[model samples]
Target chain A: MIASAYAVPSVLVFVTSALLILIGALGVISVRNPVHAALCLIMTLFGVAVAFVAQSADFLAAVQIIVYAGAIVVLFLFVIMFLGVDQRAHIHFEPLVGQRAFAGVGVAITVAGLIALMARSHWVTGAVSVSSKLSNGSGNVKELGTAVFTTYLFAFEATSALLVIAVVGAVLLARRERSTTSEEAPQ
Target chain B: MNVPAAWYLVLAALLFGIGAFGLLTRRSALIMFMCIELMLNAVNLTFVTFARTLSDISGQAIVFFVMVVAAAEVTVGLGIVVSVFRRRSSTSVDELSEMKG
Candidate 1:
């Protein structure tokens, strides 16, 4: 996996993915239009997929692309288009005084904790051997499927039900229904 | 030199920070959605890194499920955003505060 002194494939992949993720995040926040924001999100998704590939999770990378970048982002775009919301509308920027302060403090504490954890821990570096039972490199898909069907079947089914509920709720919310009741007198 | 796990973690942290900053500063609902995606990507990177470091397929499998859920979330979230826009004609989160007293 190592190449020239200055350039390694892994390093290249990591740097590129990291850069794209950072740019996409910045774009998401800085962009004014929802459509553009969704597009930026696509970029971020793509970057993560690349990172997955770099980690030797080829199947996961493919799934990441197909699901998150392809289906999810497209859905987001469809909704943004259907909404027809004005992109140039005036927006208020006043921060909530208490919430903002609280959020800042919370983030600071989390960051400090994470830094301390990183500093205290000794990370081991080596080639990890795969389990003999799962040595075929069918990757996570086979293992996950086995786990899901065998041990976590109930949880999987529950998740499916939850997804169904979400879909039904989304449909109900998005549908435009005609008013059937008499209108109230104008105020 | 080969890419280290630390590099990936640092990148993920940077991306997460950017997402947080965007979430805090942006008034557009669309931008907020994008920031959420950014956060999700950060998590994805962590999953991939762990899978590689451990040489296990389970991390990749977790990434697979995450991708599926992320897709579903985006679809439903966008649908909500569209409906909200249709009702108000605006996508700015600040202006959509109907519960504000």
Candidate 2:
């Protein structure tokens, strides 16, 4: 009874989040509407954040919700709305003649290989290593901040530079043609 | 509950496979982009699972970088998608076949 009581909550959370993730994942691929797909992606991201929390990775869980579910998916929806690409897609058509068939075979092979490899080897098994050094009996965010500012400082700074470049490039790519077209129109 | 960490890894693999399948089979560029996001999310799950198993903060830290890169990719990629749609009223990858030689 003691063990069963201990297991109940975690098991329930795990099963709930797992179902959410799987259903959202399938919806992402199977749904014809891009907007719906974006929503499904948000669901998947939330489910991942839940799983991260379950694993005690509080910082990661927060970032997953903030960056992924907050920023990235909203951008997807923005593009979809602006581009008006949310019209129902013709799901039956294939641009490449044998692409769909090849994809099916490749996916089957990949799943089979992964399952075989995972089942046959005990590669992922290991004692749960607590992040006690980093967390240090404090908040997980504090630990994550310390690590980012110390050992991973260079990488963290480099990511900022990369983000700046991406922003500039996106602006240039989106705006360059408009200026050029306007210039030609006045000609 | 003592959910084995291996189960998480298996779940991650399954999600990744589904993402790959969508990436290959879908023709809509937007949906394809969403599929790629799915793949990235799956990778994030894998990283967190390994982090939990190894008791390492580094894996979770790497997930931060991955999220940053993914955000950058989405911004730039969606810009390109919008430009393509502006030029041609369709976001279908098959329709953007102007490069066919």
DockQ of each: 0.48, 0.65
Give the number of the best model, judged by TM-score.
2
- Tens-place lDDT digits, model 1, residues A133-184: 2334344556656755755566567667767877887887676654323243
lDDT of 1 by residue, B33-94 (tens): 77777877787777667666666555555565666576667667766776777777777787
Candidate 2 CAPRI category:
medium
How displaced is residue B30 in candidate 1, in Å? Answer: 2.4
The C-alpha stretches of model 2 lying farther than 4 A from their native spots are A1-6, A125-139, A181-187
- In candidate 1, which residue pairs clash? none
Candidate 2 lDDT over residue span B10-94, tens digit each? 7788888889999998888988988898899889888877776666777788888998999999989988887788777788887
Model 2 residue A159 CA deviation (Å) reads: 0.2
lDDT of 2 by residue, A55-160 (tens): 7778888888888889998899888888875565778777678887899899889888987887788747654544434453333677677778887899999999
For residue B7, what is the lDDT in candidate 2? 67
Give, for candidate 1 chain B, the lowest lDDT window spanning 10 residues: B56-65
